[model samples]
Target: MKTLLEAHNLSKLYGNGRSQVVALKDVSISLFPGECLALMGPSGSGKSTLLSILGLIIRPTSGCVLVQGKPVEEDERSRARLRNEFFGYIHQEFAVIENETVEKNVMIPLQYARIKPSRQERQSRILQLLKQLNLDWAVHKNVSFLSGGERQRVAIARAIINHPSVILADEPTAALDRKSAEEIMGFVLSMRDQGCSVLIATHDERIAKTCDRVLHLVDGRLL
Candidate 1:
């Protein structure tokens, strides 16, 4: 399989000297197209920090990330472009703009990716994505009016709008009921089956078991 994302001997440090916190120490991971990988650990085990680095949102203090064998430098402009083009993130909080309409939120990625779509084209695709998640009815509503499940669906649609090669989800199902969690996982698994590499940072064993592989994060090292 082709590697979609790779972290080479990565480590992240915060602060300086004696007060510095080592978030990730010599951690390396890779995600390939069409596979799902899960990272399981308790709080502060460096799962989210690792995902941030792989997504190119946060730079690693040491080591490098490569996309298709090219090293990702600490170029803000370039990294932002790579993030829009290559990775999709689903935060634990489902970070949607509360004041924005669902459709507007979904279109954010298209803008970031510099994809110029005709108004109709953009509307059509966003509607289609919302419809897929049974969210078409909520398309015009502000995200603040939606329930937890609805918000997550909107987040999912937006994350996938660019058809990203890799997706990093942090505790994707932690806030949902079992059925809702399963429903969300169903969509994520479908994405994997359709060739999107997925990396999930979660503490739920049941969720981890659904993936192609599950690795534990203990003291910043994969177990």
Candidate 2:
């Protein structure tokens, strides 16, 4: 199978000279279609940095990211396009708008879609996904009123609403209880089973065990 995403000799540096910190060092990784890969490491071990680069959320100080075997240009427009069209990102912090309704937050992605959906179609799709994630009841509730698990569910619904080719999750289960974590993983893995490549940065052994492959990182380098 063709690789869905590839990172070659990637490195990210912050600051300069004596004040500089190395976030990622010469790390290379790949995600293939229909596969689930786990990135396990301690905090500040570069898992988030790698995910950011792969998802085009940030540019690598060095090296390149390829999609379907072609190197992506480092232009803002191109990056934004790829991020919206090809990548689904589930952030550890639950990157949802606290003031917005659950339905509105999930519909944000659809607005930027390459071929924008009709207002009616967008509503139907959001409703269907929220129902699947068991969040239909909170469709009109403000995000700030929801609990951590509910917020995470809203994040998941937003991430996959665009039907991205790759899902990049950074410690998605970190803030959830065991039951909620399992539910979250189930939703993510279901996407993988349906042919979306998945890369999750996690500290949970149980979560790592469920992936098709696992990679370890320490001090910015892959082990």
Candidate 3:
């Protein structure tokens, strides 16, 4: 399989000198389409830090991220564009706008991509995604009215609205019960089967077992 994302000797640090904190130290990994990799580690073990770098949310202090085998530098404008175009994120918090309708939220990524999709097209996609994620009732409802799991699903729909090549999930199952977690995991796996490479940062044993591969991080390094 062709690699879709690669981290080369990546490292990150906060502050400087005695006050510095080494968040990630020389961590590297690669992911390809049709694969789901689970990232496991204790808190402050650099799992989230590495995910943030891979997702283009934060720039590493050293090393490079290559998307499709090409190095991606810390160019704010282009990096932001790459993130918006090729990467989808399912944050632990399920970052949904409380005031926005589910349809509007899902449409945000497409709008950011400047596709100028017609209302019909947007609605069609939103409805299809909602049904796929079993969130149809949320289509026209305000996000704040939904439960946590529902909100997560809605956020997921929005992340995938643009059909991004890669999905980065941060503790996706952290807040859900067993059944709901399994359902969400099933949806995530479905995306992998559909050719979206997935990288999930999690400590959930069930999630780790469900992954095609597991990348373990310890003390800022891949173990």
Candidate 4:
């Protein structure tokens, strides 16, 4: 498969002198088309840091990111555009606005989408994704009123709304029961099959094993 994204010699650090903290150290990884790559490690093992850098949410203290064989500039404007155009994230906390209705929450990305759709088009697309994620009936419900599983599905719906080429998922199934988790993963794998690359940060061995390959992280280093 062709390389979709790559992080080379990544190192993220916080603080300075004796108070310094290392979130990642010389880490390098890649995502390829039509694959789900698992990134597994204990809490605070730099999993999220790595994913955030790859998602273009933040820059590595030292390293570079490449997309489609070309370097991605670190300037906020360029990175922001790339994120809106190419990346979708399923955050562990289900990052939807708690006070917002499902319809409003899912439409957030469209505001920044490179190919902005009309309000009518956004509604149509949101409804289609909501239906696929079993969220159609809850379109008017505020996120805070929904259960964890439902909220997670809403997060997934929001993630894919822009039709991103790379899905950056942070503990995607941590909020669901077996059945719901299965359904969520099935949808993710379906995305991979459709030529999207899925990079999932998870601790569940069962979930990790389901991916095409798994990379283990320990104490800010890839193991």
Which candidate wins on TM-score? 2
List model 1 lDDT by residue over 1-88, tens digit each: 6577888889989999999999999988888778899999999999999999998888888899999778886769889988887888
lDDT of 4 by residue, 1-223 (tens): 6699998999999999999999999998988888899999999999999999999888889989999879997588998988977999999888889999999999999988767899999999999999988889999999999988889889988888888999999998887888888888888878986778999999999888789999999999998
Whole-model lDDT per candidate:
0.89, 0.94, 0.89, 0.90
lDDT string, candidate 2, 2-41, tens digits: 8989999999999999999999999999999999999999
Compute the lDDT of residue 89 as modeled in candidate 3: 95
- Model 4: how far is 145 from its true place, Å? 1.4
Deviating ranges (above 4 Å) for candidate 3: none
TM-score of each: 0.97, 0.98, 0.96, 0.96
Instruction: Select the stronger candidate by TM-score from 2 and 4.
Output: 2
The alpha-carbon lDDT assigned to residue 217 of candidate 4 equals 94
The candidate 4 region of ten consecutive residues with least summed lDDT is 186-195
Candidate 2 has a TM-score of 0.98
> Which segments of candidate 1 are over 4 A away from where they belong?
none
Q: Which digits, one per residue and each the tens of the lDDT, describe model 3 over residues 51-142?
A: 89998998899989999999986669898888888999998888889999988888898787756688898889889889999899879999
**C-alpha RMSD in Å of predicted model 2 compared with the true structure:** 0.8
